[model samples]
Target: MRRRPQKPRPTGASQYRINHQIRIPQIRVIGPEGDQLGIMSPDEARDIAVEAGLDLVEVAPTAKPPVCRIMDYGKFRYEQSKKVSSARSARVEIKTLRMRPKTDTHDMETITRKARSFLEKGDKVRFVMRLRGREQAHISLWITKLNAMVETLNDIATVIQTPRIEGRMITATIEPNNSSSQSSSSSSSSAPSTTTSSSSS
Candidate 1:
């Protein structure tokens, strides 16, 4: 006979609404216009929301008495989308580069070139040095190599993670120098001075 597969457990957010034994608590209703309608029964709240051609969504379900709102679900979802988009637009991207401990000088130079490009593009880089065979016994060599790379890029990049061994690899991360922004701002400030001189004399 075949056995049935076990169902996966619900997440913390899902578990509450599923097994809640309390009464479908009455929700105080409020209109989208920010008007307070005071406390009302669930059925009455639903009726009021339907009359306004909107949804009766529970806003604060954990309050002593839950609160419901009469609002357009479509408009509410649009506002939420705007908030998430704005947050994502403010975040910077990160890039990664991988190398082995036995990597030669030419290859290291190529990798460093790529790392510099990433930093110039306002992206952070993760440098990974993978170890093999007896190389794992000489972890110090990996640290020394990473330090040299950091020194090469010190003017344009800042170390975010010091070299550390994890499993069979040593890893480090670096971000673009914050001074890049300051220098750009200073150059723009000088541009206005030049423009003012041209305008006056």
Candidate 2:
């Protein structure tokens, strides 16, 4: 009699061991809802995962006997990717928007729009109001103008550094309001049904 060929195991995302890829003799299993299911063989655990229509993922491989969880592997990987992308976008980098004291209304609007874009992406923004020659005499006025310029982003950011004159420059820094953004990101991800019912006109 001829022996049947063995199926190949999954071969991507080495950061995790999933399904038949888990070759450990014994492992600790966690249920779909995170309840501990005690020690079991990988084959037994894989059986449960298959019945539940989920993947057995080795989450804590360093732990004694190792720990595995039954979950939707595709969803888990997608959320992890989203978190990484969010982290990179939210990394605090100071972006400077420079304008002279004599910078006009139209130019100021353009600057504020650019600043708003930076703040939305969770970056720190520094507004620089440069003063030279006689423009230095109106430092107070320029500082007020700078403050007003940043007020446009009041809903999305907090002023970290108030506008202050430093030699020939007036500068202020504002950072994104993380609490609001994080709350939105953490909210339930279930998208609403978009199917519409037809009605008689």
Q: How do the residues 1-201 of candidate 1 rate in per-residue lDDT, one tens digit apiece?
A: 222212224435533221122236566778779789888776776666666666566667788687767776556656866987755533555566778777788888888888898778666677877788999888997799888987899989988789998899888977789734544554444331101100000
User: What TM-score would you give candidate 1 relative to the actual structure?
Assistant: 0.46
- TM-score to native of every candidate shown: 0.46, 0.57
Give Cα-based local distance difference scores for all models. Answer: 0.67, 0.76
lDDT of 2 at 36: 94
**Per-candidate count of clashing residue pairs (backbone under 3 Å):** 0, 0
Model 2 error, position 189 (Å): 22
Error of 1 at 79 (Å): 16
Q: Residue by residue across 146-174, what tens digits does model 2's lDDT show?
A: 88988988988888799987878888988
Kindly report which residue stretches of model 2 are placed more than 4 angstroms away from their true locations once superposed: 1-14, 78-94, 102-110, 120-124, 132-134, 140-163, 173-201
- Poorest stretch of ten by lDDT in candidate 2: 192-201
